[model samples]
Target: MSYNDRFIRACRGERTDRVPVWYMRQAGRYDPEYRKIKEKYSLLDICRNPELAAEVTMMPVRKLGVDAAILYSDIMNPVMSLGVKFDIVPNVGPVVEEPIRTKRDIERLRPIDVEGDLPHILETIRILDRELDVPLITFAGAPFTIASYLIEGRPSRRYLRTKSLMYGEPELWQLLMDKLGDMVVTYARAHVAAGGKAFQLFDSWVGALSPRDFERCVLPVIRRIFDELADLDIPKIYFPGVSSGELLPSLKGIKADVIGLDWRVPIREGRRRLGGGYAVQGNLDPAVLTGPMAVIEEQAADIIDQGLEQPGFVFNLGHGLFPEASLDKIAALTEFIHRYSARQLQNGAAAKEAERA
Candidate 1:
């Protein structure tokens, strides 16, 4: 089967010819070709330009032969579309203006007009779906992550504003979450309608909340987004970052088809926690790609081995590619996983059969 078909099947908890591989932020700053494109267009420009976005999205697939292509965009795009002002600073990540402070601030936030600010994202998806050979996945910021930005106003080491609202003003926090949940569902559904085959909800800051806080304040909203997208037939991937291992079980009620594991959680442990039915993606440390090819191969091999224990698995780095990662090493890892992991699986299965005989 083709890589895209294999990936889609695996995400649905079905067997595939081999483990499918892709990367978070696969179409970003690592590739020289991507850099050349960026010189002519800014990060926001490329995301807003369909042709440029499509070109960037296809670069990794062409260079590394990845199984899927994520739409070239950021977590804050939807927030920007919702009338919040923001800018992306080089190395510094996103900076948001007017942090939500009161019930009045939450009430003032507008609904996203998917047709208005995000038309280019839809156009890019249409272009990729037509031209690219792999499955095109699009993403949105999960409610709490978006809320974190809206509350804290930027990337924060301590999510003080977010927790203050959650713990101190419980009713207002729930109200904000309720509103953002509705927006996430609408945004994800729009991508599916525009030809995106898969959707990922990036809960990048949800780890800041305790398991109790997450279950009380965040889990229901995440579940609602996934449940709303359940009818779309596209797999939904929920990726909660660092120290989020405990949050895995809370995902049980959410209707997501895939669970994305970060490097902090081992793939075997994540599989054990998430159980056998759902497809799992990632857990490889993205930093390993910066090391020697041998080390990269060793880490990739281990992740793939653990992934095979599950019914469906898609190989990936735990998070977005670092700007300085070696593209050649990434290519080598992809080819190695595509080639050797299947053989390893075959040899193991044959040994089991011999033992049974």
Candidate 2:
């Protein structure tokens, strides 16, 4: 099967020729060619340039042979289009000008004009569909992650503003979350319409909340977003970061087709907790790519082995690729998945056939 078909099938809990491998942030800083392109254009600038974004998006697929090409854009792009002032700092992540601290602040936020602020993203997806041979996985921040930045106005080690509001001003927080969920559904549907084959919702900060807080404040909004997109028939990958095992049970009622496991959660444990109904993606440490080739190979093999126990698995790093990650290691890791994963699948199938015989 082709990579696109294999990936979509994997997401749907259907049998495929092999486990498909792709990477989070596979199109960015790890590749030297991407770095060169970034020098000529800012991250946001390139994201808004359909030609340039498409070129960067296809780089990792061409170089590392990943099964999917994620669109070259940051999660904050849609948030910015929602009337928030933001900037992507050099080493730092996103910084927003004002956080929504009160009910008035939440009410002040406007709905995003998907066509106006993100026309280039649509154009880039169009180009990618035409030029790339693999699946195109577009992404958006889950309501909680986007709300974290909007509430904190920047990356925070403590996420104090976010929690304070969640606890102190429950009504306001709910309103804000509801608005963000609406934005996610709108943005995601637009991406699907623009030719993206699948979507991944990055709830990068959900682990920051306690299980009670997560259930009360986060899951409902996430469910609404996924529920809204139910008719799209595209695979929805939900990635909740850092020790998110506690949140998995709450996801059972959500509409996501795939649950993305971060490095902190073991894939086996994740599958067990999440049950057998949905596909699971990731759980490999991105830091492993910075280690020796042998170490990377061993770790990659271990992750693939764990993933095989599940019906649907997509090979990926737990999080985005680090800027300092070794490109050679990534290339080796990709090739390893393509070769070793396929062999393992073939062996498993043969064993099953023999057992039946």
What would the TM-scores of all predictions be?
A: 0.96, 0.97
lDDT of 2 at 349: 88
lDDT of 2 by residue, 1-357 (tens): 243578888899887777788988887787788888878888999988899899988888888877888999999998777788898988888988787787878898889899997798899999988987888999998888888888888899899988899889888888888889888889999999989999999998899888888998888888888888999978988989767878887778688899999887788988888866889999789888778889988988888899888679998888889888977888888888878988998999899999999
lDDT of 2: 0.86
Best by TM-score: 2
Question: Which stretches of model 1 miss by more than 4 angstroms?
Answer: 1-3, 352-357
Error of 2 at 144 (Å): 1.3
Candidate 1 local lDDT, 1-357, one digit each (tens): 344587888899887767889998888788888888778777888888899888888888889988888898988888776788988877777787788889899888898888897888889989988897889999998888888888888789999888989999999999999888888888888899989989999988788888898998888888777777888988889899767888887776568889999888888888778755678999788888878988888888888888887678999878888888988888888899999778977887899999999
- Candidate 2: segments with Cα more than 4 A from true spot: 1-4
Best by lDDT: 2
Scored against the true structure, residue 166 in model 1 reaches a CA lDDT of 91
